[model samples]
Target: MNLSIFFEPLPEALFGGDDNPKSVGGYIAPFLHSFPDWRSAEVVLIGLPEYRGTAGASEISFQGPNLIRKELYQLMKGTGPWLVMDLGNLLPGIHLEDTYLRLKEVVEMLVDEGKFPILLGGSHDLTYGQFLGYEHLNKTVSLAIVDSQLDMQENKDAAPDQSHLHRLLLHEPNYLFSFSQLGYQAYLTPTTTLAALEKLHFELFRIGQVRQQLKEMEPVIRQADLLSFDVSAIKHQDAPGQQHANPFGLTGEEACQICWYAGQSDQLSSFGLYGYRPEFDHRALTATTLATMVWYTIEGFYQRLRNLDFQSNNFLRFSVGFHDNPNKMIFYKNRQTDKWWMQVDDLSGQRPPMVVPCSYQDYLTAVDGEVPNRWILTQARI
Candidate 1:
């Protein structure tokens, strides 16, 4: 697939410090000058300036991708080896579904090629296309969405804004194994939607709970094959540029924390950020916050553990037995990163024990003869 056909070069104004070798702009300049081979690049950036699915904010000013670029270019480069290419803005299709199809094709191609694609959104609804792309691989996907409100609504007329989740949940040839929502503001989520999520056994975390338990939330995000973050999930003060931003959402720092965890996970394959609107921005604080989020994500990526072998001395194993049950709960801790994981016996007998990303807190819960909610939820999903 010739990606150039679907993308155009980024504007000159967004480029920063190409002459300064220490800056991220300088490190990424070579790829822009002459398109780098996609096969050689480990990470590729794409801007999908699409807002057709949104309701009142459907048509964006188209300055979002450039705005973020300007901010991101100013950050200093990390010592970690990174090969990145910015494949400018996507060409929106004539119809909404057409844009979705185009996004799926681009993302599907990138995932198959073993390149992680970092997407900039025109709207949060674009996540559906990202999810659809994975279906082509014929693999069950676990998805995590960070937003202030559930995007699902029964209204077919408001397809993009209110009905994206409706379509995703009901779409045939379903590949979704688990779906999680983080940083949702309770009042903003409809009662029916919340009930429906519970009925489907999907995980939903409110902003208040997440602010208090970020450690517990890490394992939840670690389960995701792909993650889509709606900038509106951040408080309006932190991300003022998003069209549907709320006042009581995640703080800028909290948002970055989750991004870092998402990057560190071995299971995570794709990530996307959506709902930026440069026109509504007053001082471009949202762009800077987003740049910081991406920077932290990259940092976590470089900090990833290459060794997955549980038998190696790199990990320490422990088993906790319950007084009432004969079964023993097993856990593993990475000596290098101090991260923890749990072993779930596969009841189906098709695979070995499932090594799930967990935390020290979960281990403590098991030691007390109480099964952590994380373990219960994961078992139900699998």
Candidate 2:
């Protein structure tokens, strides 16, 4: 775990005037702040420099962790009371399989101590390894992936790559509960892949729809056990350092908001930020934006954990349901409201029923006899 080899040569800007920098082969030392028990801190930063995946991201991604770390230190300088450690980057040239195993070991150590793990990526493909970390814990975890493209590729015949999502979903069944894909767009994601997602009934949402109703999207975010963020999901203007930038995607602010919301949830345990290249960025805006996003996520998580009291069921409530027909008609009642209802087309989509507001109790009674798999809900008081 001696990390001095990596940080010994670095300037004071990187070390922040700490005792001799701790050194690790693949990891950089933490730029110690004024805190003494920092090792017992809540959040640990792990950098993965393995950039073997994607078309041209690997070479550029070597700079990802450094840039983000620098920017974060600058932007969050005055912010008091945060526990973080920069564990540096994973060494280059290790087999992808081996790298995954090592990262898993690191994450497990962090989580067992009630600490949150924040990983900075070499590429989006690192998610496969990242997710694997939870395997030994045997806890069923949900994935919330924020990316412009569906990294779920059909083939896993080669080394780990952006298509890592496909491998994770197909192979790790017991370890995973559900995967929520966010910031998806019809233009960036291939039609065939989107069709596959539709077939799977996996939770997927376009960025536009999310912006329209964040209230509804909040639940989907809270349900995640781990959040993997691909910077490409942010608009090119806001996150231009990414290898493949989407012209119209989430703004940095919107992405930060979503990250904050997810971080606030008790279910979320870890997060990883991917696809940032320092050299390609102009004025280091990309790195700064990433650092800020991470800060917000951490802040949100701490705030919620403190204010909401996870042990209490204060925010828990049940709401209305609807059923138009025993077999055909279905209704979605908002748990948050007494009158709000979202109409569902008949199971076969062949019948039309009058859509109207109804009481939660009435909606629940209608569907009392049967269970429906899919529907919509609103927060309107009927």
Candidate 3:
């Protein structure tokens, strides 16, 4: 696919003139006079300036992507011969749905080629398009979303940003294997919506629950094939650039940590950071915070261990037997990363038992002759 036609080059002024050898901009191949060849790049950076999915479109919203780039390019490059390309801002199609289609095509093509796509700046609804990119992969996918509130509005007529989650759950050709939501505030989410997600056997982690045990989030994030982060998930004080920014949410440091976890996941192929509006920003603090998050993600990407082989010498396998149950629980711990995974019997009998990411606590739970909640939920889905 000739993706160049769907994108426009970044403005000359956005580059901020000089590319210091120590800075990230110096390492990145930005689309300017011509589209950079993305085939050789391991990670592709895409700027989505489309905001029509939001309640109202502002001219200033179009500048959000560049503002983030202005801050990101100044940061020092991480450990690498960085294989990164800035694909410039995606050009929105004539209709809102058309824009979604364009994004779906770009993401599908890049990911199909084994390149990681990092989407920067757009309404949170754009995640719908991000999810659609996986439609043709011929396999089910796990999605992890970081947001302060569930976007599952009941109103079918609601704006895409408000109702995208509802649409996603009902999307046809159902390839979504599992859905996990992180950092949702109880006060902001509707009880009915929570009940619906829980009924579907999906995982939901409240902001308070996550903040108390941030490490527990790693397994949830690691299990995802793609992740979508809303700027509104950050506290208003830390990131006031989103229209939905709240006084209470994940701190800037916590947000970066989550991004780092996502980057290290071998299964994760695409990431989207959305809901940033420059018009609402204060001294570009939100942009700086977002840039730092991206920096950590890139660093984590370099640290990937690719420890998927359970039979390898790098993994320690443990089996726990329950006196009350006939099935024995099995677990694998990576010696290098100390990460844990467990096998759950597929009750549906349609396929083989599934191995899913779990935490050290889950292993301990099994040692006590009890089934972990993670195992139960996974089995229920199967």
* Alpha-carbon lDDT of model 1: 0.83
Put down candidate 2 lDDT per residue, 1-382, tens digits, no spaces.
3332222122346645433233121123364432223356777776676676766543553667877877665543223245566655655435667777677766766676677888888778788777887887865677889887787666655435657887788774567756778888877778888777666666788888877865556666766778998898899899888776668888888888987787767667889888777767989889979988977876676655343321234333233343553344434333322223334454444556423323344345544744323243211111
* Residue lDDT tens for model 1, 1-382: 7877777667665562476778777766423454557778777778888887776654568778777877887889886776777777788888888989999999999989977788988788899999999988777888999988898877657657567878888888988988999988888888888997887778999999999998889988888899999899999999899776577888999999999998888788789999888877889899999988887777677677866999999999998999998989999998888889999886677767778888899999999889987788777777
Candidate 3 per-residue lDDT over residues 1-382, each given as its tens digit: 7999989998877673555888999888899878999998999999998888888785655888888888999999998667998999999989989989999999999999999999996999999999999999889999999999999987867888999998998999999999999999999889999998999999999999989999999999999999999999999999989896589999999999999999899999999999999998989999999999988888888889865888889899999999988878999999988999999988777889889999999999999998899999998877
Q: Which one wins on lDDT?
A: 3
Q: How does model 3 score by TM-score?
A: 0.98
Considering TM-score, where higher is better, how would the candidates rank from best to worst? 3, 1, 2
Query: What does the lDDT come to for candidate 3?
Result: 0.91
**Candidate 2: residue 18 Cα off by (Å):** 9.7
Assess the local accuracy of residue 134 in candidate 1 as a C-alpha lDDT between 0 and 100.
94
**Per-model TM-score on C-alpha atoms:** 0.95, 0.75, 0.98
Per-model C-alpha RMSD: 1.8, 8.5, 1.2
